[model samples]
Target chain A: MSTAVDTSAAVPLPAEGDGTPLKKRLRRAERRRNLLFGALILPLALVVLVAFIWPIGSLLTIGVDNPEIHDNLPRTLAVLEDWNGSAPPDEAAFRALADELAAAKGSPAIAAIAKRLNRENAGYRSLVMKTARKLPLDAAVPAREALVAIDAQWGELATWQAIHRAGGALTPFYLLAAIDRAIDADGDIVAAPEDERIYVDVLLRTFWMSLIVTVCCLALGFPVAYLMASLSTRHSNMLMIFVLLPFWTSVLVRVAAWIVLLQNEGLVNRLLMWLGLTDSPLQLLFNRFGVYVAMVHILLPFMVLPLYSVMKGISPVYMRAALSLGCPPFRSFWKIYFPQTLPGIGAGGLLVFIMCMGYYITPALLGGPKEQMLSYFIAFYTNQTINWGMAAALSAVLLAATLLLYMVYARYLGPTRVKYMKAR
Target chain B: MLQPYASPVERAWYFGMRGLVGLILAFLFLPILVIVPLSFNADSFLMYPMSGFSLRWYEEFATSPAWRQALMNSLIVSPLATLLAMVLGTLASIGLVRADFPGKALLTAVLISPMVVPVVVIGVAMYIFFAPLGLTGSYTGLVLAHAILGVPFVVTTVTATLQGFDFNLVRAASSLGANPVTTFFRVTLPMVAPGIISGGLFAFATSFDEVVVTLFLASPEQATLPRQMFAGIRENISPTIAAVATILIVLSTLMLMTLEWLRRRAERMRGARR
Candidate 1:
């Protein structure tokens, strides 16, 4: 193909009287086409940049954003600027804190500052709130003495250190907290308390659950894909509807179906009782079991579709040839057929795994608190706790994992795998 | 079919494989099918031994203000989002196919990133981004977010259709004294209409069924059907959700059938031209 193109280029076209001018006109026309195409794509490119890329980029930056502390406590931060780590902050720092608290009393910024401080030390929220509430603005005594009287926590070295650490415009607090590590009182990174060490476990659980779901999907999807591929085209087409039907159905409805089926009095439990399998209904819903069931059901088609597409392309001739050479059927199938389907398996497995890692609704509705994945925590922080920084940090982690998997898929299996999935 | 030269053991293996496949298919279909019958049950509880068949849950769904409002919201949002997605996605796809440009691959990746990114991530990011702009809990916000999610589908379907399109037809029309706009309307649009319509259908369905974003961004007034159902399932499992699910399932089945029909027609048209 390259030689043919080269020869054609070398031969050149039959020249007219004004060949150079005509060539220039062709080049201009090519440029015009390029410009038109760029013009057409401009709207979509802008929309994606504004709506998708910009928002995500901003959200990820929240991981290091620490404006609430620095903005609200400028005076306190300034007074503590010269304090060393040898002991508690001086009277001047406490005096600055009391004055800032009095000046900013009843302000929303104070509350925001309190929330930020609370994330660093467990009881600092109440301390800040209490100090700001009872600050003696009209007292004759020093502002430091008034603040210390209001709350002795103001005299603690650790409290001053937390405020000092949060003084920076950009802090690693949220990101560190996301991985279940935090800055200790002496400015060293250490593991969070035993009970607070939940994010790492949740992240691990997210990976483990996604892995299990992917494996389950593969186990259940392989035979079905094989059957679809080996069957007559007419039969395969009929069977394909079953796969496509669920694929087209809303994921929520499918999850709702699982809820109904797996509930204590629902179909699965009732069937178990009817068959004399157990004395009581099992604790199926609101647990890992329920999460696995629903996620596997929802993601099975993602696995099967790719596997079937790849399997469909594999000819039966190779397996037959191996069997005709006196190779046993199972051995021939394993060595000859399975190797040909690896691309499909890789595509499907990666797709399912990535999807399961980020799943929220099914697990949220069906799983217990402990069974929830990292996405659930991200939502929890975003909606319930109203912790945007923590939410963004968690999201950054999820986004990283997803992008890494996508990069691998694009690099190895090629972008066609993604395009093929979309086509289905 | 199994070869005649195969041993009995091989035949048994084939039968076993078929049996396993059949069971797996059953597993896939059973849960979805169960909801259909359970939706009609007179009892409110999702349990066995139906008391009798009635449409009480369906009636409740229709009469309840929340469910009705949610349905209305979904009806309002999906079409608007679908229209926006169709316009943007179709134009982008046409340009992508017609011209070669630097960073085209990167641009395609970015446009399709919404589909690949986790909905939770998108939801949180949009929530934070929209809060200050006052887009959260508004119709415009939901429509825009849903449109972004839907664009990739439209782009994919339209690009596929255009791949088989002959650009010479447009040139032929222009050479024959027709304007470019007229050539597009009279020639190009007719050929790609199926893809556009089906892509629109997908966009509409995606918006209609989306929940996580709605949960984060929608106000009480803008709550969509899936959002309402999610609340229902989370707070309480009732037959009303079943009725809603049943309706949605039937609606999706119809959409799937329409898409399949469109695909077959498109194939036949392409074949005839060949």
Candidate 2:
């Protein structure tokens, strides 16, 4: 390098070999590379746009998308616009609703509209369905009285209020209901009825459970991760297999294992009973304890890996220096060593917490009614109940929480090189 | 980890932490390893004190038509999904790492968002999105959804591998009258093959273990092993599930071993090259 520098100093600078300048040539090369990269990326970008981003981006909107009543009863919504919510709609409005219902009768559209309205008022499903069944009311008889005759709910302002609330193409009914809030007759958000207000509690419970799990994982994982970090590479690699093995194993398998071990007649309870720890088998399965155990066990690796990497990077010099400076071993260890591992703590804790927020099968299989988290309800609404709006709303909440934590992760903890990642 | 000058309390703490770490490591294996012995129990029940060590559950897993179907479906779907993910992910990774652009971080985030997004959300969203396109309840949609989940792993692994890539070699190849395509095929692909394969392995493992998306996107005919196990756990705690879980545990251990070995080999290759 010194010889090259001496020759360059002795000789004058050379001109560009080609017509183009070096900077321009570099710029052109970069631009070509960019074009090639852009072309290469197009396929994956398309796949992500079509299969990943677009679906999730649009699915979140379904939470506030209120199209059922708007599509099925368009004329009714138009007619109900001028009328106040103080009383039932006028004759023309009822006639418009009857006409729309008759037009939508015997099709899935009516059921969808009825489902949407039923969300507004509980019994309105039967009212709308019953009215739709006896549709195309005689033009001779007044449409209002005729509809009231089919179902007394059609005569009430509350039923009309529901249809009016669901009038818009995009309404916050499902989203509001997700947080246990509802729009009332006065167009004001109100607390959902006590009997139906399960979501707010569920959301809080999801976060609370996640927090508990994160703490438990950190506590359990810190020592192991620290030990692994302090160990030689061969020993640490041996220990990592235990973490990686469970991690790669199917979640269903882990949940299944928990069931076998935690049940009354399972190994755990039997051992406890045999050891005289308790006279009876503890109610370990189908409870919060079981859920915590499984979640912590599952997520502990996520905690350990990140912390291990961070801890691995921290030199032992500081601890040694602190010890030599007349400081207590434990105190100096904490004062010197602990602070540096903060980023790892933040990374792993946030990672495990973010993962816990979206947990489904663990809580579903292990925990009973009170233990069900937000994902449980998301699945319930999506599958069993087929309430896409409710499902979408619940999903939006969970997705937001996840993205927020991820942003925090990205911002604070650096790039998200997820666990079981890294070439090593 | 210990110092000779350490105090008595420090010594106790060290030993205590070591013992605690030991227990925690054991805890990690408990749920996974506990089920293995039970899978061999002669009895149908998932209980302690096995009637006798037997292969009845394994036989049941092999013979049962549903289990057979799940195994077949898993074998079929995981590979197809892995292929799709590997192709897209490798190409994307190459582009993403080679090209400099604004918002690359954002783009990377978007690419890998599938890994972070809740599975239930992905399942529902895919259902809603695919239903309109007539993709749901079909093998195509199932494969596509699995591919989406798998893509992030491939992208991440391949990207990381590409970061340490020597671009001078590509320049050298092109200067030697090799076209860009030949340069990529001959020089670039060979170097990054380990990363691509390991990433594909990750994708395969993900697809193999996936149950939530399958629940949403698949028909009964497309039930994967995990899906069947999910049903088994929910309805009845059969020893057959234990058998299935054991096989999966073995498979995962194998994958982990392959990944670790491949990682070492890749490191060695890079080391030798550098």
Candidate 3:
């Protein structure tokens, strides 16, 4: 290779840094750097494209695509296309509806279609199933009479319209459920049942818990991180073991530990009783209190790491200079030292808050049923009820909230956060 | 210890606050400390009054089929997922930190989004996404889901490590006739090994602990340890759970120790190499 390169050389080399050829080499090096950088980023971009973007796109489509409605009742839908949202249709539409319903009655499509339509109306399954048993003939009977002949419930026209409205590929069922509103029999948005109308509250609670956890972690972490930054690197490294130990521990173990410690006959109660602080054991487990304790413990490191990184970068000279300029020690520390650490505080806060919002396990295990977060319901709809539509909608809301907070952080706090990088 | 920095009035406040925070840190570790001793119980029930220190629970955990299976499942899934996460995440971290590209911030956010998004959401998403692909309840599905969750940790750690990286080293390598691939292997991966390893351990521990997503994505035949523990916890409270937990605590402690040592070694190595 060396011989070939030497033979191919067009001209003799001059001293380094003196030749115009250096510029060409520099350009080639620059191009190589660019290529390497591009090559490195391309794989990651592709991973994100497949992993995050594709799944989210498919998830969002669940809120609209009513495949069950489209697939199971093609003839009925096509015949009723000209029904014009008036009375349920003439005899031809009724006959088509009877035929489709009769065909789907015993098949998997009926159950699946029933499940989809039930999101619109809970009684749709029974109405469709009952109407299927009797296939009314096309005899020009009055609209009300024709429906009555098939099933008395169909005379109301609302159930028929639900099936009719859902005939289109897109449906508003999931989005409506997301807002705690569902389409009424008459096609109006109304509040869901009292028991089921809990998404709004769950969303609110998720926000509130996240906010509280962020505040708690920030309050606790700021001081510790500051101490770490101010101390010798030796001391800081030693202290970091405490932060990293929990990081290495399984979250499940941490929560389980909380369960044991917070129970009625747990260590805390034993200690309290031994100390004569309380005669009785406290009901500390399975509540918001437990949720907070475990969550704060688990998330404490998230808050501390960012703050430590930021604080480590700040020069102590600022505080010393302030003190030399006739400022009080405490005032200098507060005014100069604390202000610079704000970037860390904001970054840590945003990170902690965003993490807390998505908490599921600690809250699920330690929290009461009422204390469950939005993630709980999202899971329930997905696993128990198999309602993918509502799950997608709820997930969308969570995503939106997360994105909004991220936007706020990026727009407002991003620039100040640069101080978090240690100065070389 | 905190009082020297305090004023007359602030002295008492500092004492109380420092005492409280110290107590809180102790409290944070108390559960782990408590369980270690409990694992030596002679009796089957988990109670305060120790019947006598014995290794019976440990023996039971080691002997029970369910417990053994759960442990095996955890052992199998966590390391695999961790390795996958380390590879993808380190690659991603290098890309994210070293490369300047449009939508880099969004890309970073997307990479880390799995960390904050509810595991249940991930579970549900995987369930719906993987069901059609026939991946539900398989080792591959669970590992993929866990790797997705674990990637963010590796990326975060490696990115943090890379922030302190010297680009001049890469330039030096290139000037010495090393190709980009050679430079990355020689100069970059070695530098970030500690962060990568720590991130991998965190990723493994993360998957080991995760239950909700496992419950949704994994089948009964493929139940991971945490999923098994979850079933046991929900169905009945047993000393077996405590034993299982204690074993995990021990394993995690070992991993933590190794991580600490590796990190310290990496720091020293970096200093020496520089």
Candidate 4:
């Protein structure tokens, strides 16, 4: 570096005739500054790429990733390629299946195949496991007869269709299943059975719950935000602490607080019973009501923060002008005041709605089995069930929704508005 | 304040609005207030009407190995993650402010994506990506994941501070006898110190309160305080969790107070300069 600087100085001294030496040095310094800037950003850029972007991209690919069957049962997959789904697998396919299963014995690959196939059909796991156990690779009997004798499912065309569908290097199984739709026997997308149609309802429930929470926040937050905006700075700052206190509180602690207050014999019920509002202790926790109460409580600050900022900016002269012109107070408020606050409404409503959609801990603690949202299932698949494909598919849906909302926010309300809201 | 030219109905509406706002504020603050007393309940149950006041729950939290380990892990992780976030985020913010390069918006968006993207998605993705490299359940993986999450806060705070900063001071220092590093330390660092410290506080809070990524990434040994609270709440509603929650509430209150103080200091410094 010192040698380069010295050389540059040497060359620039001679080039003083063509340009000023100071100009040349300044140009070199600017170039070096840009290079330093790039160098400074490189570590963070690489970290985001490796730790944030790449993982999310790869996780989204899990929906279409069907390497389990494709990589495991290669011989069977190849042989079954020629055999159409119209009939049971031919003898050659059976022999290929037997070879692959025998080869995959005492290995994790067979279990992978079984798990993949079982996702398509319930009994396919036992069928494959049983068939592999009964028929050895070196069995003298014909492959078709041995497999059919070992399990009747081997003779069914649906079983072959499922295996064929699961055979490809990439499949839409998980993405379809995530929305409670699936490829049927004829390889057509169809709605899953009533019992199997869970994810769609859960997704809808997630949206519905978020919408309710957003509306609740708006209804409850608007007046408070207005009050804060209208109050003296000293009084407003005192009130702002109340709002920011909960905002800064740990989410788990807040959820725990709700549980302590809303349980059967908890404070809320006790108060209600004492006030003669109810004869019996109300069931509040682990229900939809509990979920709503806790979610709205947790999310109200989010709504109020943006609304307060926007309200603080709104001028009172417009309302006074409308009132002087004999417009009713309510009408002036509805027409002049509310229209200007739409940006804040849009910002806070979208922010809260998107946040509510991705909420896991609050809903999981307060909501019951039927009240759980898409995030709950995402966690369930990732942790408890270890179903990466479904987890990824659900996460993709959530990411798409969040990004879409973010884009809308960026386009209309501006990203800085959201940033300021967060920082405040 | 209401206008003097008002009807009786308008007066009624003003009082009603005040009442409603008061109720909403109560709704926001009540739940947080309720937990402080419950944490000292002598009985294990978290119901209303405490059997007796006792420090047993706090004692349990202090004595129990699980709780202590979670607290220790959180202390270790939050500070390291905060430091990493401060360095990377501050550097990136400086580069962003100084250089007018193409795709700068895209780079900024990518840096902030961890903050906006659903935590569940990030957790699942990080788990899958790290699992193959055997990074899951390890402190290195958790810290890296957390540092990524912490970057956006640091970037935002520092950038906000930089918006009011004068870059000519940097040029003035360089044109004088100072090198870039010395100029940065002597001139720029003092101005941005409040921002850096507040950003670090934000990073610390994020890492401390974070549970979703920790759930997906941390093993039993690496269970963070929030993760432990989540388990305790899920498995059993114990007063120990209430005690932990109380401690966290106090910690966050302190952090929030510090952040507020920093903001005021920054404002005063800016005001003094003006």
Best by TM-score: 4
| Model 1 agreement with the true structure over B1-274: per-residue lDDT tens digits | 7889978887998899988888999988888988888888987787767889999999999999999999999999989999999999988887888768888888888988887888899999999999999999899999999999889888888888889888777667766876666777788888888988888887887888889888888999999999999888888889898899999999989998998899889989988998
Stretches of candidate 1 off by over 4 Å are A1-24, A75-102, A114-161, A416-424, B3-6
Model 1, DockQ value? 0.48
Give me the runs in candidate 2 sitting further than 4 Å from their true place. A1-30, A79-98, A111-163, A419-424, B1-6, B176-182
Residue B181 miss distance in model 4 (angstroms): 3.3
Off by over 4 Å in 3: A1-48, A112-124, A136-148, A152-160, A185-188, A317-337, A410-424, B1-18, B92-105, B159-189, B269-274
Candidate 2 positional error at B133, Å: 3.0
Local lDDT at A31 for model 4? 70
Which residue pairs overlap in candidate 4's backbone? none
Error of 2 at B204 (Å): 1.2
Task: Looking at model 4 chain A, report the run of 10 residues with the lowest lDDT sum.
Answer: A1-10
Candidate 1 residue lDDT tens string, A1-424: 1112222333354465765687776576676666666677889889889988999999999978889879878988987787786698777787777778777779888888888789778788899888888864556787666777788887778888888888899988788888999888777999978887888888999999999999999999999999999889889988888887887788889988998899888889988999999989999999999989988888888898889889999999999899899998778989999999998899999998888888899888889888889889999999898888899999998999998998898778764435424311
Q: Show the colliding residue pairs in model 2.
A: none
Instruction: Please compute DockQ, using alpha carbons, for every candidate against the native two-chain complex.
Output: 0.48, 0.51, 0.36, 0.56
Model 2, A69-154: lDDT tens digits are 88888888888888877898789998998898999999899889887777776777888788888989999999999988998888
lDDT string for model 3 (A295-319, tens) is 8988887788888888999987887
Model 1 reproduced share of reference interface contacts: 0.64
* Chain B fold agreement for model 3, TM-score: 0.88
Local distance difference test scores for all models: 0.84, 0.85, 0.74, 0.85
TM values, all candidates: 0.90, 0.90, 0.85, 0.91
